[model samples]
Target: MTPNILMTRIDNRLVHGQVGVTWANTLAANLVIVANDDVATDDVQQQLMKMVLPDTIGIRFFTIERTSQIIDKAAPHQKIFIVVKTPQDVLRLLENGVQLEQVNIGNMHYKEGKKQVAPTVSVDDADIEVFKKIKEFNVDLFVQGIPGEKKQDIFNLI
Candidate 1:
């Protein structure tokens, strides 16, 4: 059965304050899936995230492929909140058949090759390309760091 996907957000710092506290509580998400290949294999990072989150919320660190495979199998009552590190990861999840209706571009920190798009977002040519491809799937993409804030169209910022 398809899982109830409450939110799919791209935040380089996965399971952070905004996601762990604000967004999770706002969405009433019971499960937070941190889908990133690097974090999936890192024991220390996984441990730290477990420490940060409350015991009531369930958290998982899985690769994009593994997430795609198991996401749809979530129990009907499980409201899932997916978090990823990059736009490419969102595209990959879609390609792998994890159905997503919308995506939130939370924070993509500025880096050498990326240009600043919004105050909390930065992207390069490849990142922009991936986002455009993701749009083809009819997924709504917007930027809103916190729950109550106004959502900015990610395309406009890019």
Candidate 2:
């Protein structure tokens, strides 16, 4: 059976206190999937995430392509909360056949060329263009740091 996708979020900080505790509890997620190429192979990063995550919640680190495949075949009981480092990763998952109806923009920290869109979100020219492409897939994108925070439409911020 197909897994129930609780939430798909783009947070540069893949897994941390806010995500492992606050977001996980709010979403009632059974599994947290960090679909990031770099972290998938980084044993240290994976271990750090494991340290903060509650033992009740399951976690997986996977390359974007692998996440796209496994998500589709996940157990019926799995309620997944997916987090990726960038919009490009989410786009890649879409291209690889991972279905998503909406994506939450969270904590995209500012970099040199990136413009701060929301307090917690920043985007460069390339990111803006990639976001536009994602919109074409009919996926809704909004910015919200936590469960009850007001969601701002990503396009409006960009």
Candidate 3:
């Protein structure tokens, strides 16, 4: 079955309880696609993520490459959720021609050399550059933790 929504979101924490239980159903997302190369390769982490998803939602694992190929084909008809850990991964999908013009920036926690872009977002210079380049492709990005939170443009803020 196709998903009910198609959303591209950045959540470095990946599929934790808040998003899995709280946000998934709000989007009525029938298929949850976690698009991260690292998570796809780690069987242990993938399993744990699966365990956290509510039974009503279906989840899939894909690297950014695979997701980009399948996204346009499965979009609109599917209530989908695409979660990326970093802006580069999202940019890879965009470079591959996925037409996601906006990213819902969720929780990308702080890390060394990754400056805080928002209360919930952290970005290194490389990622910030990717964000800038991709915006020219007409991608509208916003930093918002939950579904209803006010959207903040990272470019405008930083």
Candidate 4:
């Protein structure tokens, strides 16, 4: 009963205007899954995030462990678009046996300690290490802000 995951993206913002609406439309994703511990437990934040989306698009918030279980048991007809907060989260899911075809690096805005790899992507030393581990899995990883934009491989940038 596993759902067909259309796209998996890493965006620190989780569900935002562009990613929640535009990316969902572009990918034709009927379901949006935000897998993060903090947001999943925050009722106010969850309500706010749900308020922004159109009623037609279903959305769910689950912790990483719960998300792995859901992904493993998703319905085949469901087109799931997953959004996680970090590369480390992605790696955690992979380690838990959540299968994904490719991962899109959406946004990871620059912080004091992070290095800018692209216009939108910035990562610290730990982030780079996580990316390296993900690369080892041979998962197709690239950065594309939106559907029409060109995707740049993380390997090449890092």
Residue 122 miss distance in model 3 (angstroms): 1.8
RMSD per candidate (Å) reads 0.9, 0.9, 2.4, 1.1
lDDT of each: 0.92, 0.92, 0.81, 0.90
Can you list the residue pairs that collide in candidate 4?
Answer: 1-74, 3-74
Better of 2 and 3 by lDDT: 2
Every model's TM-score: 0.97, 0.97, 0.89, 0.96
Candidate 4 TM-score versus the reference: 0.96
- lDDT per residue (tens digit) for residues 1-158 in model 2: 66799889999988999999999989999899999999999999999999988999999999998998788789888889999999999999999988889999998999899899999998999999999999988999999998889999999998
* Tens digits of per-residue lDDT for model 1, 50-148: 877778889999999999888877999898999999999999999998899999999999989999988899999999999999999999999998888
Measured on C-alpha atoms, candidate 3 has an lDDT of: 0.81
Count clashes in each candidate, considering only residues at least 3 apart in sequence or on different chains.
0, 0, 6, 2
Comparing 2 and 3 on TM-score, the stronger one: 2
- Candidate 4, residues 57-78, lDDT tens digits: the string is 9999999999997687788878
Better of 2 and 4 by TM-score: 2
Candidate 1, residue 34: lDDT: 96
